[model samples]
Target chain A: MTLDVLAAGILSGGLYALIGLGISLVFGVLGLMNLAHGELVIAGAYLASLLVVDSGWDPLLALPLAMAGVALIAYPLQRYLLTPLLRGDKSAPLVGTFGLSLLAQALFQGVFGTHPKSLPASYADSGISVLGLRIQTIYLIAFALTTVLCAATHLVLTRTRAGSAVRAASADPATAAVLGINVSTVYAMTFAGAAALAAAGGVLTGVAQSFTPTSGLPLLLTGMAVMALAGIGSVGGVLLAGIALGVLQSASVQLFGGGMRDVVVYLAFFLVLAVRPQGLFRKAATG
Target chain B: MIRSTSRRIHALGAAALLAATAGCAGNASSSSGGKNDDGGPIVIGTSISLSGTTVLNQIRDGYLLAVQKVNAEGGLEVGGKKRKVELKVLDNRSDTNTMVQQVRSLALTDHVVGLLGSCCQQNIDMQGQADALKVPLVMGALPVELLPKGKGYTWDSFQSLADGAKDFYTVAAGAKTDKKTLIVTNNDAQGISTGKLWGATGKKAGFTIAATKAVPTGTTDFSDVIKAGKSSHAQVLIAAMAPPDCFAMWKQMKALAYKPKVAVGVQCAQTPGWGSLGKLGDGTLVQLNWSDTAGLPETNLIVSKYGKKYTNLTDLGSVALGLHEATILLDAIKSAGSTDADAINKALAKSTTVSAQGPVKFVDNKSVTPTFIGQWEGGAIKQVWPAKGGSPLASLTGLG
Candidate 1:
């Protein structure tokens, strides 16, 4: 493969993995499929875009502030809003998250008015040349940050007391609760962490592409595909899945017309899942 | 109370106008069979994007202004009776599906004599619905693929300038100073359609199509496409995308120092946002069908009046085209005499009229007069082709 294509594939893969990490973390620990996770990303992007476009903040400067705002809402959303629904049937959380997705979409359109807005980030286009491949400075930076974040998540799960509690809850919430692990608290924190990762993905995605209110659906699908291929709760699995998915998707577009790219990627995802439902490299369940 | 009274007034006024026009039409028909008398106001129907994107409002206003001017001049005489022109307006909501439904609604329900205002490409595909219903669909801003085909049902869709869009060989034929050329297209129907158009032209133009990259729409990171172009040694970068994408690309192009002598773009280049590009938009030329700076008064007056109605000022590019569509439809209706769809369709098929745009006439294969090109010069889009109808020629400089 040409370095150009490879670079695009790899950089795009990194962002995909970041999104996957959020989806997987929530799905694995909370036992809730968050259809609204993509909405969270869209919200983060619009939040940052509003700051950059209307408030005149640099995108880089707005990222942390936007992340904080998301964090503030995300934790409460998980605790008060989501926890009440946990008493209902299994579909309650799923239905609630779906409603949240629609709500977020409506709110975005209501506030932003369905027009294209941009962050106008200064480093948006910055890139450096190496090995005859022009690597975008932003892509490289995003890739690096993704790796760091994923690694940090791994460390948190394996090394710290919080990691122990989170892994304990993911493996067996009832057992962890019996063991005095504050399982309810773990769920909220896990969801909050997922939200933060989603916020990061949003900032990176907005910086990488121009976004609108309607952009969340496709991005959400892509994130879901990556998560499914990577396997739930496996950080490293998500990375491999993202990379493989990104490369295959981009290469398919190059070989075929744009129409076939999605079909090809989804088929590949199905094939991988059929062959190894647990993922290509499934880590053992840990507590 | 106010709403009820206004509704009653509107209904009475509309019914009375309809009856009077029908009586005038019957008398005219008795006098001269079917030939136009050159003295009746025509009825035209337009379904444009009035609210979505705000810019569409400018375009709708432009068409209304054209109608206002024509009516003020006592309407065109058709067959032997004086009839005042009327415009039946519908808002398409900027949705493709809605556009098709609205066009059909305007034709079958509203009974508009002629159709106008399809500035976007996808919306023009809705013209097929119009064609199926046998209405004269006069669109001013659609690409070649969406143009009326085979049947004469799709009548004269005009362009403001002679567009060089069909010439793919220009890109291929031009000797490239740099080895690589990257084609960046937005991941949407318009962007894909433009990329296809460029590919057809580029293959003929003689430049090697090194890479065709699709950047997902609303993508914040453009590094992938820009780097791919750079690595490919694409000295020429062509993007078929919106203003935001271009803004992102240029910012990246500057940071990466990827300078090409011939960096051309398609779509939204003539928009006011491109003017904000300052020097960056400088060396970049685009294929355009019309520009306001060409000293076409019919064009200028449409802009001035439309500006007052829509955005309080007439600087938006799409507005001028929308107005042109409205006027052309009005011309057909005035020429046809009655508000009958069949009559107006025939009039549009045979009529030759001067638009706020250049002189326009329909040809065979459901196509209108050919298009020309325009470039943004010093914040004003100036026509720059054909030598005769073109803006003053300028030497090609590198895009920095």
Candidate 2:
């Protein structure tokens, strides 16, 4: 299709990757599919709105604080509530996270009366021309921010000592614990870190589009799709998969029609899962 | 072999996770539908979208206001006896399936005499439930033209899309534009019908249809649609999608510099949240079912009661709709003089009740309300068309 359309897809994929990164990180580390990840993302948006909408602070100014705020809230949730469930039956954490998602949705509704909200910015509805292609200014900022966050996430996971501890816990929690690694702490940290990423994505999303209490479901599904396409443990793969899903969606809209966009994306997601259960990007099982 | 089995288990677990999350996402639940004992208060039930993405609190308030007024007058006279009305409202959270189930339950289980409608597509879905159970359902907020042909159980009293489109084009005719229009709507039934009806009406009004695209409900990307609009150099834009879709598309349209001289976001830009877009939201046009300047019945009362709660004309219109719908149903019950479903249905067919939105008479299961074209200006919707009891139109500054 057109260069502008392709560029839009790629940029949109950056936000998708940011959303997927959290789900991937959580599933890889805790082996607990956190259903509340989308809520975490939306929680970030609402949190930023407090500063942006109420106090008239810029959305970018509120981004880090929102990230830290959601991460702080998520830390205790994983450590106290979800981590304990992980020690129990396999289905417990899944059900527990689902329940948390419901609880979060209710809390959001209770707090922020069921109206759609957005973070207003000068660039929120502006455009920029890159060479010959026109791009949405918000999407351009979101893409750059997503890329930096994704790269930072990769570096943190691959280069740091905390990353090694995360890998250790992810590989074998029992052995890692025996070797003096605090598996529970690492699990909580990873979940918190993933939540931070989701919050960042949420802030950008709030800047990009309007969101409501129930906006998390579609985002959660998209994040889940990204995780599925990227496989369990690869951060870089999540980025690529997000972009691929974005391009596929754009291409599908071009070829089929806008009505078949989700259908085509989900069909491709299903086919990819059926063919490569591990994922398209993951080379092998980490353990 | 162990690894392969483990892989299968993981896949199955992932599948189950997706299924469970999907199942729980809607958060669909219903409040208890109290028993409707013989000679008890007339139980009128409604499955409304009180919460979720599309909240209709203003309409709900209208329903409550009409019921309160009737109750204040010592209730409706039914079967030679005055009985207080008990409105059983269940929040459907804007889910169609939930709305259908709740409406069915309200009819069969709760055994309500009549039903009140939710907004938009939910109301359309509720029509089927009302028909199957043969419960007389009255609703507003949904355009009259989009009401699907049903078994006469559902009655829609709202603004007609054709009338609104005609009024909009009439307004557009005076504007400086190329007469080329680009239409985009969500691919849902209502959205599709909206696109067709608006397209037909625009063409009739001498506007050329540049392109009409139908995207899904949650679609965030509009590059394809924007490209089409730009390529066609369409000066008039009509989008009938959800609030979120409109928000994104409006932002993207402004960003990509696809400036339509006159943009009317029907169904989408009507939401109160549209104001949140700030300056970017100004100059967009939306159709209104009621305008204060129209001198509708109960205007003073509506303002006295809800003027503080709902300041915008759009919300006031919704409240008037709720009041209009409920008043008609209660009047039908009074005319029938009994709680009998068939009698109420027959009475509703011949209903002529006047409330906040003026006189409403159902002809072919539809009542045409006065349609006014409103423009978003300084975060409030002001009537900008009709040249009578309306302000002068403003240039679209939102895109620039």
Candidate 3:
């Protein structure tokens, strides 16, 4: 395969990593499989489309506002809706998120219409060449941005006091609650934090490619595969798994063909799960 | 033993997940109820997709438009009595199983005289429903070649893929490009037919097929196809797929810096959504099954009535197809003088009527409509072929 093909895969993996980052965090810390994760991502893109397409603003500048908008919506949703359900059955949150996904699809259709919309940027169609290796300009930007976000997220979970509380709550919710930590509030914040990451990924996706209201489901599947590979709770592992998927996808397309992409990637995923259920990048421990 | 069972279980779960998500990813639904406004006695029912990946708003509007005009003329005169027509419509929400159930309920419970077909693969699936229930269904939008052979109940009167391929190849023959071509199509029945017929016809029209890639529906990746196009330096590109697929592929092709001298999008580029791709979607040629300037007998009414919603001729093409299908079925019902399935089926086989797409003659339960070549320009498509009433062909711009 050509260097360009491999380069494209690794670069696009940045967005995939960002998508999986939120999913992994929520699954690991909050223990909620957010099926509505993809909707948050698309919501960010649709909100930004108003600025990019209607207001004629630069997409890079609009990206933060989109993330913030989705995060704001996500915070209230977790606080008012999902947090109550979490107090009872674990399956309640999963079903609620699925319903949220359907509701989001309906809302997007009602507001934005079913037509495919793309956030156009100057660098969206062009690429830069470095030492005879050409890479897509958007993917290159997305990769750098993904690295920054990954580091920032890692710092929040390690250095910050809130991160300590989240770790405590995640380890033992009842004990953490007895120690004066509002475990439910931390859970809501964790969900919001993950949602913001999904929004960032969504904005990047919008600038890179076209999106419809229905685009979220395939993206959700991709994120699920990454989370499965990364084995929840590893921020860095999410990045690695995302890049691995991108490379595998690129290699398969360059080797077998585009039609065999799912077959090849899914088989590799199954193999990875079978061989190492704890994930390829996670630490193994025995009690 | 546990590991082996878990592996088997994982494989089964993965297979089921892929099966569920395959081919039908677009899940947005829009609903529109039908009107039996005239309070007519004859009830014609349809369970077409109102929302989802394959939205048929235009088709639904076309059905209503035809029904409205027919009802205005005191409905169909059946057995020397004027019976007003009432259409019982249900939204299938773009699910094939829902469509099957709704069609059955419409035919057996509601007792409608006939059924109208949905677009693309849904129409193919509905054929079995029509045959099994012994109800006559007139379908459009899907190319005739992709449909099954005449089975007495289903009548297809749409563009012939073979005829469209010849027209597109003849149009491309005049373009300034290398003779090498690349074919990228969806791996569905229609997509396969389009690639095969277009490649075979293109070769006869002096073009060589350099590479061919058949991808699954809902595929957003085009790197493999672009790699082939780049290596072969294929100057002619033919893409036959859905709008979403074309939108994704066109962006990827541009991002990869692979530009064909002449690119034609069959079945995918005709949607009004193609304009949303902006400059990247420009210069793509689309083979149209119907055109406003084709000078058909019903063009005046189609434009004048549906002009507000469908100002662009390209958007009106499929609507005209739906309008003609309903009109043809209505005429067949008029000739039958009864709503009997056997009578309507026989009448439809020999039905001869004119539509917005021009002379509708059901030869072997299939009719060939006039195919027009259109080019994307200025947020709309203009007729670029036939060299008579069509505008002069323009050089393709927007390579990047």
Candidate 4:
């Protein structure tokens, strides 16, 4: 394959990793699947649209606001609505999250109208040539930003005291609660953090691609593919999985015709799952 | 006092329910005819995709605009009796199965004399229902030739894909480009059909079919296609796909620095979303079914009435399809002289009404409309073919 094709795939993987990071954080730390994760991502993009179109802010300038706005919404949603349901059957929250997705779609439609919207960024279409290999400037920025976020997230989960509390609650909620850690609050914060990441992914996606209220489903599928490949919780593994998925897609397009690319990538995903039940990258535990 | 209040409330609720039923039931109590009765207004129903990925609100608006205009003129004359045409619309929510169920209900329960068609696959699926239910279905925004030759129940008046292929070749002949062409299309029915036809037409026009690639609907990667375009060094490019698919491909093409001297996105570049790509979208060509610059019959009326909403030829094309489809159905009703489904089916097969897209006549339940080539200049589309009415064809620029 040409350097250009490989470059496109690698750049695309950065976004996939960003999408996967949120879902894995919630699923591994809070033990909540967050079926509406895609909606959260889309919600972030919608927030960016409001600022960029109405307030005339650059998309990059408004991205942090989008992330924060979605985090605020997610924090309250987890605290008030999803947390209560999580106590009952797991399916309750799953069902509730689905309903939330529908509600989010309706709200997006009502506020933004049903038209497809894009957060216009000058860098969205601009590109840079790195030693003769052309790459989209927006994608290059996204890759750099994702690397920073991944590093920061990894540090928060391992090095910080709050991260220790989150790990304690995730490992054993009852024990963590007895140890003076508010399990519910930890869960809410974890969900909120995951949401912020998802929103960041959404803003990047909005800059690169056009989005509608229904844009989340494709992203959800991509996130799931990365999560499945990465196995649930390894931060580094998630990044690798994202890159793997992005490369798989680009490679598929290069080797097979573009018509059969999806078929090839999905078939490869199934094969990997069947062969390695844990995942492609998960480390085996020692007794 | 409580007992009296409850009785009054119950009585009012019952009275309101009865009145609503009576009104929706097509005035059956009056001899003027039930909603479907020839004596009353002739009802035509459609289940349009108002939401979801395949939103056709422009097409829906077109139907409403035409239907409302007809009603304003005191309705259509059927069988020497004056009848106001009432349109029954249901939001299909962009579900094909839901559209099927609604179309059946409209024909069977609502007793609408004829049916209107939605765009793309929905219309394709509705054709079978129209024939099985024996209700005349008037449809546009889809090439009728694509449908399997069916009974005389479904009549289509839209542009032809083969015609689009021919038109593209004719224009590209004059533009400066090597005769090598790369054809990329979606794996879906319409994409494959357009690719096959356009490839043949390109070959006939003395251009070599350098490479052809087909991708799925939700495809976001165009690396393989880009590689092919680059290696093959095809001077001409044709991608027939949905708008989203084209959007991704367009960006990737630029990122990889593969610039075709002449490129046409058959179905994808027609969307207003293409404008969001900034100057990267300039000089990208698309085949048109309707253009404000073409001076087609009733185009001014269509544009002026719904100008604010549609705002572009790409969108106006669908609206014109909906309007033309509705116009033919209305014309058929007048010719049928009865709201009877069978009679309407017969008359629709023989329908010949001049529409915004010009004279519409169905031969074998299909009619072909003119196809024009257009280009995205800045944020708007300009008709660039048919030098008599449109601007001269411009060379490809600003792609890289």
The prediction achieving the highest lDDT against the true structure is 2
Weakest lDDT window of 10 consecutive positions for candidate 2 chain B: B23-32
Task: Tell me the interface RMSD of every candidate, in Å.
Answer: 11.4, 6.7, 9.3, 9.1
Number of clashing residue pairs, candidate 2: 1
True contacts kept of each: 0.18, 0.67, 0.27, 0.31
Clashing pairs in 2: B79-B337
List model 2 lDDT by residue over B1-400, tens digit each: 3454345446546766885575445333333445544766888988888765667778888888988999999998986789888888777877788888888888888899999998877888888888899899998877787788999999998887778989999998888999999999999876887889999998889999999999999999998999899999999999998889999999999998899999998877877878889999999998878888777799888888999998878888888888989999999999999889999999988887877777878888999888889999888998887678799999899985
Q: If you score just chain A, what TM-score does every candidate get? A: 0.94, 0.98, 0.96, 0.96
Docking class of 4: acceptable
lDDT of 1 by residue, B1-400 (tens): 3454345445545755775565335322111112123333354666666433432645655666666777788765555555665666666545677678767766666555666755666445756776787877777666544564535656545542224554323432343455355788887765776677676666655566778877655443455566567678777677777766676677567656777656666764645545444455665667655555555536556555554543311244455666566666677777776566678777777767766555556666334534445555564455555445565544334245
Predicted candidate 3 versus true structure: per-residue lDDT over A203-256, tens digit per residue: 888878777888899888889889888887888888988898998888888788
Model 2 residue A150 CA deviation (Å) reads 1.8
- What C-alpha lDDT, on a 0 to 100 scale, does residue B24 get in candidate 1? 37
TM-score for each model: 0.74, 0.91, 0.91, 0.91
Whose DockQ is higher: candidate 1's or candidate 2's?
2
lDDT of 3 by residue, B1-400 (tens): 3454345445545755663464234321222233222334777777788666556778877887788889899889887778777766677778899999988987777777899998878989999999999989989877787778747788888888788888888888888888899999988665776688888998888899999999877676677788789999999899988777887778777777888988888867877767766787778899887777667767888888888987777668767877888998899999898877789888888887887677777877788888899998876888887766688777667554
Model 2 lDDT, full chain set: 0.87
How far out, in Å, is residue B118 in model 3? Answer: 1.0
Candidate 4 structure lDDT: 0.81
The C-alpha lDDT values of all candidates are: 0.66, 0.87, 0.81, 0.81
Candidate 4 lDDT over A189-218, as tens digits, reads: 989998999999999988887677888888
